[model samples]
Target: MIKNHLSQVFYCFIITIILVFNSCKDKINSENQTKTEQTEVSKTVYASSVIPFFDQWKLILGDGSNAGIATEFENKDFFYTQNDGKDNWVVFKSPNGGDTHGTSNNTRTELAQTKKWYPKTANDKLSATLKVMNVSATGDATVAASHSVVVGQIHSADAFENEPLKIFYKKYPGHTKGSVFWHYEINTAGDDNAKRWDYSSAVWGNDFSVVGSDVSTFPEEPKEGIELGEEFSYQVVVKDGIMNLTFTSPNHETKTFTKNLLLSEYTTKSDIPEQTKKLFFPIGQDGVERSEAYAGEGCFFKLGCYNQTNGKSPEVNKNWCSGAETHGGDIQKQYADGNYAEVWFKTGSISVSDTAVSNDGYFAKND
Candidate 1:
């Protein structure tokens, strides 16, 4: 009987020890999982994380300042990451009524990457997948914004005040359709901004030159246009002085365009517009146009929401008045109330190499 009692006690003791050991191990694992969650929440997702060749680019915020050299993942307020239940996205936002870079009333949260190339530089490409969310709503409805936001730009880094390309998305109020257009800003021969004007081209609808005379009017609706939240992509390939653009959509047709950046088509007096002739005639800018164009200028690329909206009312000037509403520079309220521009990019790449880049996603599974 004594032996039996001792044996039972021994079995109970062994079981008690085993249970305690298992419980502690489970607690440790639980703590570790919690820590992992917190860590992920602390870190920000970056364009480099989502796109290929992120190291080759740098970010510039709306205030005409560099976000950084692109080493850090994010800038606190101007640039950051957001997840919309399906995927993580890099958000570029800027206010309508704000300070701007030279010769621009609009502000931008954009990324710029310089390439060692001239006007006739070839085999350089920049591509991205993105969508534009909102633009300024208080401007003249008859102007470009009845609804419009600039989504992409190709700017010259040299002293020439020229932009090789500017991509625009515009929609009218109380409509579901919108248009996509691009413009090539003329290199005004010298630093004379008064003699500058852009040559507009159409991708999905009317070009930059198509606009209503007054704030209450709007251009014709684009028969085939992309709506807000619709995902689209654009690829810019500069080869031998010709800029070849390819725009794609999941449900829409894929379109391509080509332009010559080496030669200036608007180099003569007749090329000057009647509007610039009337307005700038007093300034004596009618006889000046870029003779060689953007040739040999070290041009750069910029991508982001360059808010086309301004504080001026449509009643003020149909051309410059975005007449959109403003929230007194309150970024939080503006973001929440849809008073600003927001753009998202899933993936992008810049290939300076002469070889073609593959379409494979480097961080496809990271989401």
Candidate 2:
């Protein structure tokens, strides 16, 4: 009787073990099925669907891969579509030490317009509604380009290869809000790029000249500034060598700027702004722009996250170099430590016109 009882208990224990094993297996299968379903749902949204202009542009990811004609394409590591419950946005993410473009140390996951046109003869416009999501958190506070990203640009592809417009969003670490500024890189005379310098203009806060005293310290935050994740819109209209820029944000004052691309604003040494002299002259970058700035130059529009943070030593160029942590160029590690830049665009459009539209009352309406 004792043996039979022991046998029955052993068989019961085996049966219970098998039941528990089956239950755990079923749970694992269910979780995997749920994950598959979630992935299927996420695959429905594409970057091209968000902007609808992918066919007219070529994408260069931070990994240095050229995603040509990126329609119906998405890369979760760099370029992808993200939804914020209220709306869907196209996200451009780049690491600080990833692959970069020609001769540029900074990495970018951006869209370059395929068709190039001369600013003098062509009337083109590009507009976008975007917000900067993140910037490199580990960098010297004294560095001007330490925690910033370029969102929009009109890049010249000819004659000295300078940029006429670069919309930037910069925020120092420990600051509540960042500054919205634009830069105009001079087309240096005699094709000498080493002397090329950028003139910065602020739209909502301090310009690029604002910096901290030391590596870890930061300046006071801007009173009227745009915080991370705040929505803003920028419109760039290049009409016959004249560029008109408009920036608009909710609860903040709208700003408008007009520049003639055919004429040089910094033709002589005295034409340099005082801000440039104090900030850039120390770095030996006080070059003057050509008399005809970007005249008849082939240019195109670029929109996305052009990461300004780099791992270069700040001792070389304190203003441009951030000396940020790059983790030996490992992208995964850099991203984990906030050594990256991210920007998101909800809506964007590009149009070419034979006629120029009037921007009348642009400044007066804001005032």
Candidate 3:
């Protein structure tokens, strides 16, 4: 009887052990399956994706008489020109005293035109390449000065009423020597009239003196001389009231700049009744005049835009004050507007070998 009881006990113990081991095996298998499924899903979602946006436009500026009658137009098909005859005239986006002579009729003209085309989606990103070719210029050259290329909004009257983002480059005989200069002016039409904030050589000069009651409320200028070039890729991204500007070189080196101004800042104070919401890209301070003194010769350039948005995102509000708030969203909208973001090319008797555009990029939106 005792032997029989011991056998029964042994068998029961073995059975219990077997059951526990099988249960554990099942649990392990289930866990592994779940992990594998998750990995597959992640791979499926993150595969390379294509985002569509408008590509850059090719523009031509020519002298009317010798280049003949150059007719420039911008539409869905292409941004182009037909030259008449004269080839001695130089093309300019920003003309200074000496360089003005080369411009037809000594008047700054828009060689291309664009219509408004907003994206259907919000929070999208866009990018493009700006190629500035040195066409030709004439006469007495001095120190080559830098040229300014800008990307901003244009108001109803075609006036550069709003503060547009700008990039400045210096032109020398053989070397390109210039840095990006980013400037912002708040309450521009009010008691703060023309009170500007610059993040360029201003830091080097340490001068914040400007016309405004709250000139005392200015922030210290950030670092300047961030270099950019042909081999470098420049990109801007905007989402949910944030603006991120990035520059990547061929070697994969990247530098980023960011700023967050609030939407309320876009509003005008009761003191400035003339202020209105407008977007603009005026030739920056470093046009042909400055280049003549700095660059040994002059330069000519072109502007382009890439639009990538489906409109599912939020529409850009002109009243939004802070580009930081909209993330990269505002910059994306500017590109989608079908306008060539303003950029200056150099041509003439000067050399702008080392001129570079600034990385002062931004986005704007509310909430």
Model 1, stretches more than 4 Å misplaced?
A: 1-44, 75-77, 84-86, 272-288, 313-318, 353-367
lDDT of 2: 0.87
lDDT of 1: 0.69
* Pairs with steric clashes in candidate 1: 137-324, 138-323, 138-324, 138-325, 139-322, 139-323, 139-324
Sort order, lDDT high to low: 2, 1, 3
Query: Which one is best on lDDT?
Result: 2
For this target, which candidate reaches the highest TM-score against the unseen true structure? Answer: 2
Query: Between the candidate structures 1 and 2, which one is better when assessed by TM-score?
Result: 2
Model 1, 1-367: lDDT tens per residue?
9999999999999999999999999999999999999998767576566664656655667765655446546765567767778877777888775656555666778776634456565567888888877665455655654356777878776665368899888776555677788877777766567656556667876665566656657667677887777788999988878899999988788889988887777777876666455434554445455677777776766787787776666555455567666676666666675667778777677777443232112112110
Clash totals for all models, in order? 7, 0, 79
Q: How do all the candidates rank in terms of TM-score, highest first? A: 2, 1, 3
For residues 274-327, could you state the per-residue lDDT of candidate 3 as single tens digits? 212112112111111111111111112212211111111112321111111111
Candidate 2 local Cα displacement, residue 315, angstroms: 2.1
Enumerate residue pairs that collide in model 2. none
- Where is the poorest 10-residue window by lDDT in model 1? 358-367
